[model samples]
Target: MSRKQYSKELKLELVKKHLEDEISYWKLGKEYGIEASIIRRWGHKYETFGEDGLEKQNADLCNYSAEFKKKIVLEYLGGNITSQDLAAKYKIHAPSTVRTWIKQYNNHEDLTNSRKEGVYLMAKNGARKNTTLEERINIVEECINTGCNYASTANKYGCSYGQVYVWVRKYKDKGIEGLYDRRGKNKAISQLSDIEKLKAENRLLKAQTQQQQMEIDFLKKLDEIERR
Candidate 1:
């Protein structure tokens, strides 16, 4: 026998009774011919994301296979499939992620180069950088000119808003010397010189390390298979 699809209102109404302890779940499930879990889900959703979660029936959610998704995206990036065609084929939860992956693949060389030279130093956390306080002052001024506010610049630079604000004032009056992060202020961000650069480089290195490990493990497995 096929299961019947009940409307959201009926589910919510049943959930209300369950919450009140007005009826046993077994009796309620038998009465409505729905699973006990469905009733429990309504209660859990109410506790978490709240009533809006009530509208989502599991069937509405997508369940694309990860391997299939990667294959389709890679083929599309190679010009073997159209964007709309791929979208229809694999019901991606967010198609934009595919586009981003393709963009990253295309820019891999530039990204790799950026990671190697100390140009990637912004991504490193507590390392000492040769770039002086003057350069930081100039970047902060450029950031402000580009309409970056104190908070955003702080988050980007991985420094406190207080530090960025003081630097901005110093850069305004005394120039680069004024913006020089006072030592002992945030020994970390100050020592590193460019917190954002350091963070980005470290992130890239971690990703590369993981990828290298996976490749090494795969090669080792392949060698063992060939010997067999």
Candidate 2:
């Protein structure tokens, strides 16, 4: 699926809920139907630069000079910050923008007027995840056999909690083939029949709701202790 863009106002609102209310990112992601990683990135931006950090950015703005892109890429390679961090710091439109620049630099291609090679760099330094197809199938099967228990499945397999959740959902929607990465691209939801899309969304909402309940229970315990 193509990346979804959020407005500046929405970003600020979510950040406020995350910071001022002390809500967990995963819960917020469930409530708002956004990825928890995106919420964490917004929190990072808000902490580093305040309101201005949440400003809406678009690549079409063309505000970044070639020199600026080169500088950002160099700093990123220097290990000062991640692509997400650099995007937050510079108010770049997307973290992928910096990733594109970094990919170009690493590939010995020109940074200026460069394009992404359609690789999904989920980690820093353009590292491709080494999770084998067998591993992915195992993870999804385990998650299912465990009643979609993402945390336990992740722990058992040394996978991220979010990764397990995503894998399970994709497996449900498209069978085992859905677990493939497809190199930074996926079949867009628009291509799905209306009923299929609705079913997928309903499944996501149910999983997210369960996660939120767990977080709430944990927070309540913490609150009781604080009041003691």
In terms of TM-score, the best-performing candidate is 2
lDDT of each: 0.48, 0.61
- Summarize candidate 1's per-residue lDDT along 31-85 as a digit string, tens digits: 9887888776665544322233356343322243345545655676455565566
TM-score of each: 0.24, 0.29
After superposition, the stretches of candidate 1 with alpha carbons farther than 4 Å from their true spots are: 1-66, 107-228
Could you give me the TM-score of model 1 versus the true structure? 0.24
* Residue ranges of candidate 2 with Cα displaced over 4 Å: 1-38, 41-129, 184-228
Judge candidate 2 at residue 26 and give its lDDT: 97
Q: Over the full model, what C-alpha lDDT does candidate 2 score relative to the true structure?
A: 0.61
